[model samples]
Target: MEDLRIKHVSLELSENQESHRTQGFSSAKLLVVRRGAPFRVSLQLQGRAFNPQTDGLVVRVLLGKLYVTMPVTFSQSGSPSSWRAYISPEGLDPQRLSVFLQAPASAPVGAFRLLLYVLTQSSRRGYKAGRFVLLCNPWCPEDSVFIPFEDQRQEYVQSDSGLLYMGTAMNIVSRPWSFDQYEPEVLEACLSLLQVSPPHMKNSRRDYLQRSNPVYISRVVSAMINSEDDRGVLKGRWSGDFQQGMHPSTWSGSGDILVQWARSGFSPVKYGQCWVFAAVMCTVMRVLGIPCRVVTNFNSAHDTNGNLVIEEFYSETGKKLHHSTDSIWNFHVWVECWMSRADLGAGMEGWQVLDPTPQERSKGVFCCGPAPVRAIRDRRIDLPFDVPFVFAEVNAAVQTVIVRQGQALSFSTDSQRVGVLICTKAVGFPRPQNLTADYKHNKSPNSTLRSRCSSVSEDVSPRTDASHGVSVSLTLDKAPVAGEPVLFAVTVTNTEAVAKVMKEHLDAQAKEYDSSPFDSFWEAHSLIKLAPLEVKALHHQIDPALCEGVAGECLVNLAVVLEDVRTQERVLAFEEFNITSPQLSIQIAGGDSLTPHTKHAAAISFFNPFSVPVSGELTITGAGLIQGKVKYSMSALRPGGRVQQQITFRPNMLGAKMLQASLALSNNTIIRGFKMVSVNDA
Candidate 1:
């Protein structure tokens, strides 16, 4: 480990501008060898600015064919105090040379000398670069194999503790040595000297605690800074909304307001059904200065029937009732917060749970974590909070015909409790109380009704002039499940000037139409019209047995057709959607690579997202995937393990190359990612 000499040679730069600045030569060479041990030498060069043409630069040592090049151009510009350069061949003979170089014929010639030194770098951790001493004894035979420092790596021992080294020279070394001449024990001992081990527990408890409790585990998990500086567990834009007055508190409050705003309506929009709730909770906690994030995921929650009912009511009802389910939760976004002992005391600590709609709290809790005990945050509170509310206002008018289909429909009112007027053409159907009270001045105010409300009364003969018409509407009582039969009821209203004529118009159509045409023909005329209203009621039994353990999703389609003859317009009203499969989940495996430059194989698994089983191919994709087969592997992954195949990269060429590949599991599935590697040629 000692007696390795190092010398700093002067660098001479000739005062010539047009000379070939890059040419070089060296003035001397050094020899290193031991009689009975391995003959090896390493040079550590520290070069300075020099003129290559006249003051040439180059080195030839050990009377061997090995040459080290020094470009005058880079040497003059490089400011590093020193640079490392080594020469060693495992099985090569040793010799020395008075290495020197003359400038090429293309440029001016001058004189210059640059700094240089030689050293043998130890293979141990924190082993400073220095000269190595010979280990051979003179008593050894002359024919003994002489190995170069590079070749002697085989002689270096592998330490008991596994540690891979990035060699300064011999870079293509492989593992599990195949050469029979290699001595594993000697190699291990040599490596043992190179291995580094930190101190064992000085004060067992204190040292143990230092390792047990990380200095910044929570900080790493909840930080929102860039990946280089921050090691947060959760990902995505959970932290970016703090600006624009969108602090967690403001955002959460706004979401809570939306919930309260949707309740009071003839058709209340179903808002606040997804992240709305989580947004509120996350905001409230964030305002309290807690580091929190929302994560969406899915799991099975047992239903009252004790059968797992993948939650579908939230989405179906949202879409059908409100005309949209855009911001609905996909998996189920819940908030995770970094909690401390003090926070825990508040009963809202450590990833608090705020599932407000749980019917069976235990069942909802079942979906929280695989191991329910592990998922518990704090003790559950069975008591209910003030129910958040929302509201809406709906307005409408109604008209009726006496002789034809004597059905009634309602319209919005300005009364204490909003209610609609029902209009019909039947002879003895009582007048609507609200309407009767308005028309107390006369039992049948034909002129007034014609001018104001567009009413149709039945009494006189048929006439050419009629007052008004009616419209029919169909709407849903609530969202229904897919694959279920639905019962929809309708409401009709009539308003006309001439009651007798309105009756006659209905009579004419009644004789020509069956029950089916009654709804349609009434819708066709504005004079003897039908204002339709309908509510949906669905009843269907879901047999899990039908799915055969595979996830299945069904989309229910509903349509109501109304034909208007006066306007010649066909109005089709319907809502079509998938009852299940509103959420999707994917599990990726076998995607671990120590470094970016290396190509690692991986497998991706796609799930139905819902508790139901779905059949589909999974697509896998990766960056720096030099070669591979299959995107979504059908192989079921082992728990806590991965299903994977190998991808290889041979760095035969230098520079950066992108490694990317994709898996096309099913027609709709695709997964991808990438890695990087760097190589140096000396």
Candidate 2:
């Protein structure tokens, strides 16, 4: 018997216009439709037309475990022009089959295959017709998560530049977090990551939500991306020493991370920090058709004890002690997913925060959030899924303590210092949107909404009243440069009527941008009596040797306290600065434009201004422009010498491509350079 052939398959968006059409049946030609939405598919069959009453034609669709069969309905009068005119050897028109399918609301998301079969009086045979994909409906009101239509398109559908905020409020660091989700490798990696069950979840059977819920998928992704646990896909090791481990700059996009994880057979890939983890999570969520965006919280608090207060103990000379459990990060990056909370209930639906950084544990697992952003803003600590944890991250009080001779001399609490700039990528654009105001209530006194979440006030440390007589100001010498001294100047002015005796204390500490201060780089103490209207300047210099471990970017927290000897009143000032690594200049040799399938060269130059020789490795990577790893090692570079290297690559894809070069020095220093090149089709 001859096998049946499918001549054409067309997807009808409406009765008036055709949307997608393919000449033959194939999985590559997919028809995408939302669940609960009705879609029509038209298939033109090769060979002589058959009488439906006698032929018994039927179409069967298979999606995962779901299987359904329906009778083929054809209209002879409204058939396609080619279908009505084409005649086979038997002198009859070819058969045209059209079927309208309505995917059930609970239908699982997956690829659906269609098969055409005929049942005669004796035997039956089926031929593969076509395949399509069904996605959950974000438009349906009952299932919609209330994300803006444009956000759903730009954030969830399109892969492009994202924003990751770093550093503290005083020194904000903003950089582009590239997703590159449109790449085939990235999509495959996302699908693969979703399928891998975490260690704790292995024994427990997964339910429908566990398998298909966006919240569950996002939570699992958070844990799997970081290899902190046995089930993690990437082994995360943070080191300022680049020669000791993988550099975060080595990977250009999330696709690179995912591809590496997959190639290693789902083993822990390499390395990732907060920003890297958040960026990769965004890529996975977007590829899985979940609306997601990266968010950065400046002065983010890590309140380990559920008390919304981050305590910092400082020595008299101004060294931050690491004895306390509570701490504050310069900045922390995480992702927010938009989804309806069928598990949590109605009002909780919307943007849910998911942190893949693996800093803290939620539900005995090394994962955080699926915590509703609405709950955080509303101070709904009673809600499930780590609501209190996320709330403290954005609305915690920062307490600075001055301890001398094993005694607590003074303490100051600032409620507004933590969570300074909460930012995310602007909807429909690459720029950042400062969403700080959305997460916290307005500080204005007359604002009525400010008190609605007043229940959170009980958990925070009490704020001290500001002393009106004395004013303190702290300023850094310049934009902090690595391998150089950082000078901090503290100026105190006394506006009181009489001369006052005061003791001055200053503390400078180097800390991880996403965690608490490691150790104090420098500290100073002095006693000075300033007369009325008198101003005094106290300066402290942090040596470059003390900051040697400061790799790419280091966070320095400065605390200055002045105590009036007679009254015992203290004036406090705190400042944070981001010390950036020395930069390397990368320039396209000729220009920034290239033709597809052509070779191009770029020059990377860095000046060794230090007395010691510098030795490191240079890594160049580009998504569509370069194929594989291009690395060069520099053994030694004499002091006061300028070194230049050339890198050549061939472009395979045409578009705007970014070529990034990172120099990881053996002295625990890393600097990055970037150049944008446009590739045109030849």
Candidate 3:
């Protein structure tokens, strides 16, 4: 911190005509006032051109503690414009004043201005502006210098956070509303065939697992039987051998064959089985209205023998890779779908899971629920632009990209040379149930990943070809084996070789995209927006004529529409705020007559789930505010205190009135509720 300092300042004025006015420090003899002394000061103008009759005047003065003051001034016959002010010792520290005298509207038009003189603890100074020359002369000779105001240039103010800079508008193809609309019928047909029960063959024994999609599961079961018999399409199977398969569908009980099938599909070489099985399952599930898709990745273990494999390391070295050669990880894929209890059976109660091919290895799947996607948009900067390659941007034009199979994407672009790439890696069934939230205080004492982990693993970058502008490549390493961390990286570089590294970095760090008001700072930047509002003194009941006991509740549907104050532009499509008014549990309260005016006290609460604080009015149409103090509190919120109260709404009488509540939030924060409850009115 530095000590406050006051310095002497000065000003000069000139007119468009060849006349000039110079005052302060040159002609005005102003006395310096003491820091704490009582005194008196006055400014008496006397120039003939300073006529209040012809030139109207405005005077402003600043003195010590008095700061600055502006007042209109009228001219006199003897005294041009006189200003008298009494100053106590408190007012004598630093005194300054500004005077503006303009030529009267009735007077002849020309250049006109004002001059101020001051004395203070800092220093003595003079300032001037007007059409008159020095010595109170409006018309001196043409020898004086005059500078035009047009020569001055203005500078723009810049924002510190880089927020003022407008971001590039991303160009995307106008895609259909849902991913299912773009999918081909072939995928579903394939799935349908897979779901059918197999036809009985001559001398073929009946299989026990009868409930499954018999046709598809049976074909797979038959393949296993053939493999076990030492004669198969890909290779002959042998007893107690790694190449053999489990005829799970032929087993009577809930056999472990599924788990075994899952394990068998773990190898990078044999991963095609997993992909095909998953694709078929997804189609079958979708056909059954299960809403399914597949997600692919790599695993590093073998089913028959517990062996380790690393593709990158193995490809380089001449060492013979041990165990059965099956690509389970490279082309790995699994099914994801929203399933009902009837669809998944009794044991699969919570979130849906992948049906293990060999009826085994299903227990190892983790993080399989709906992983809430928190997208943090970041632009790339400081990228090398010298590399030669085709570049294009890809994004799902709709609000969200729903994962599905055989979905055709709409592609549009401005650059003819750049190719748009879309590589459907796999479908993922991320159940929202898998998410668990934990919070640490801002001041917690814990080291980052660098300080905690013994050795850091390097990132493995996937390769892309020259033709594909945006395509995904998968690489599954098997050496480290199962239970080890699997690293995946996706990079997109334009023809200029400028990669969105910063955006990628931000994406890697983002954990959740909370569509809460507490998160958006009242700004409509994200796709999803949620806000909570309150309804007070809700009258709950069923019509007396139709009622038995009090059972029905009054429900109110509310919508919030956000608008940009600056642009006055409304986001018509997705910009909306909605919350249902709390169900008022109205009771009969021992009332038999229809005219009974039963009293009730209730508070309706709403929350904003976006990162920004939202502001809008709540129209209290159904019920008006009663006579009482209005308050706010939060409900069902994460750890950090994230709630605030808006202004209170007090009604004169009990009638219908629009109770409007405006709300806003900080960036990356969410405000949960604005609860409204009325007290004591039946």
Candidate 4:
């Protein structure tokens, strides 16, 4: 008898992808399927029939040196972490065979090489079948990453477009993000992330074996997102100089960064800050079928020494001094991934904090967490994988010090200053959902924090208050918008029954979201004399052009420092004023209804708000609506002038898509807008 030769194999891509919930992602085109799901495969034999008696059909799945072999048969039960295949009764033939292969829900996830062997009593012949990518299954309950809610699965695991909260807690800015996982370049890049990781490169078998656990996979991904230790996906640039690469704020989506990294042979893409790292990490996690969301923690702290305290020094003149290595960010963005932590026990599951911003080292690398939020809330400092680091980020006390010359004249700790508000994009909405309660035991950390982190100190001293005969308050008249002057007031009240005289210094500086205030661009110093119990509201307006920086978030760090001329007692009041860019208007040529694969036209318009002429590039990116990005260089538009760009987008895939536009100006001001378009199937 001739050897059993195989002619061809069919992966049934359409049927498998639809059932596996992987069809929306571009990975499905390469036969990507979720584990725990049964997918049909057809085989054509050229020589002889597959005889179950003398000839055995064996299926092999390989990942690097690690491989799993399963003897193909009917009704065979095995381990959940093992592969399985059964003869399909739907369609069967001697020359042609249709079999269903089910990857164990707990199987290692990544690209797998499929192979088939036909063994006879006389000989054994093997055929190289194709390869398919495997992802974690949020649909299967047996899977540790299983998410029960349908809407959550859709938002976290499937939705390609999202919002990343930025700016300060007082003025929350909802910036749109295109995860773009459906883009072909993104899918390949995300998988390539696993391939280029240090662990995968050094020990492929061990890395492949570790993929069975979501925790392991998350930790690996977090470490691979920044290029500090490993030549990872992004290179962090915190010094505010992005000349080597694109500005971190210029990135509107992960697709661009991922494609650039993969196409450059895994070269680290230049310039990623907290949001960029967190956003890209979110994209990778979601593409791999893990539920993830980008979170912004306002008043976040970076305790370099790990004492759970961020000491900030201010000159007696009210200028922030770089005295301590510790710092408090206006806002820090990170991601929270959903998974079951079997290793940490039952209650220690759900959303785990994962920071990919190349912060301090964790376990000898620069990736933070898989830190259980539950553990952080319960003050479980000894938990694994940098729980203390993440806990400090949201709970660290702010130690404010007023330095005179080289001496620290006064110091005070505000337990509730750091981690004032923690939030993420609300499910099925663009608004922010406050997660502050989840991270903090109470809004006021006075007693709660002191009880927990023996590290978090009490008020060592106090700023000038009623006891000192004066109180100061800095208030913004209205939310600051880009192109419009920032109007705010400093309210100084003499609470004492006697006349009081004080020296007031007001400072306004430009700052990045994750950085401290730079140089003061605007300042005012004046001496004021107040009668008994007199209240004074001093109004000030800052020119829009004066505060805008070449590279930084459109925010103004406005501070008012007061010193009693008689007593030398001082008080400080500050406000982080974020400049909200005017939203671009997205208008569909003919309402919102759309059809797949059909060309459609839309117009994006922006009204110049500045007193000076502005020029920039408008980039439009939509995953299902368009491929990659289309950029148009806009000429200078006079102040208060309106400019609109007409562009055509063809729906390549059907589903909901966000049509997003970002206008990056020469002045470093970024204006953005988006429209959600629902496309029907063809």
Best candidate (score: TM-score)? 4
Q: Which candidate has the top score in lDDT?
A: 4
| Per-model TM against the reference | 0.20, 0.78, 0.19, 0.93
Question: Which candidate do you rate higher for lDDT, 2 or 4?
Answer: 4
In model 3, where do residues sit more than 4 Å from their true spots?
1-196, 199-277, 306-328, 340-348, 355-682
For residue 455, model 3's alpha carbon misses the true position, in angstroms, by 21
lDDT of 3 by residue, 473-526 (tens): 222221111112322222222332322111111010100111111111111121
Q: Flag the better candidate by lDDT, 1 or 2.
A: 2
lDDT score of model 1?
0.22
Ranking by lDDT: 4, 2, 1, 3
- Superior by TM-score: candidate 1 or candidate 2: 2
lDDT: worst 10-residue window of model 2: 446-455
How would you encode candidate 2's per-residue C-alpha lDDT over 1-682 as one tens digit per residue? 5434456767653331122111111212345555545566666766445554555566677754456676544432322211111112233344765555555545555556877676655547677766665555555544344355854554554444454656544444445445766554555566566556563245333323344466666777777778776546566656655554466655556766777778878877667788888888888776655678888887788888888888877765556677688878777888888888888788888888898888788877778888988788889888878888888998899787778777887777787878766767565443456666567777322111111101121112222223658877777766566668877777778887788888887777777675567666677778888888898887778777666566356777777777788887776776776766666788886688888777788889998755588899988777667766588998799977888998888887655566777788877667666665777876
Local distance difference test, candidate 4? 0.82
Which is better, 1 or 4, measured by TM-score? 4
In terms of lDDT, the poorest run of 10 residues in model 1 is 165-174
The CA lDDT at 378 in model 2 is 86
Task: Give each model's whole-structure lDDT.
Answer: 0.22, 0.66, 0.22, 0.82
How do the residues 1-682 of candidate 4 rate in per-residue lDDT, one tens digit apiece? Answer: 6678789998888888889988876444688899888888888888777666676788998887788888888665667666889886556688998878999898888988999988788877788889899999999998889999999998899989888877766666778889988887788899989988989988988989889899999999999999999879999997756898998888899988999999899899998989999999999999899999998888888888888878877787788766777888888999999999989888998999999988788889989889998898888997897888888988998877778978876666678778887878777766666677788885533322211101112221112323377888887776676666788888888887899888989888777666677788888899999999999988889887875552236567777788888888888877775776678899999888898878899999999887788899999999888877899999999999999999998887776778999998877778888888888875
Give the lowest summed-lDDT range of ten residues in model 3. 158-167
Q: Against the true structure, what is every candidate's RMSD?
A: 30.5, 7.5, 35.3, 4.9
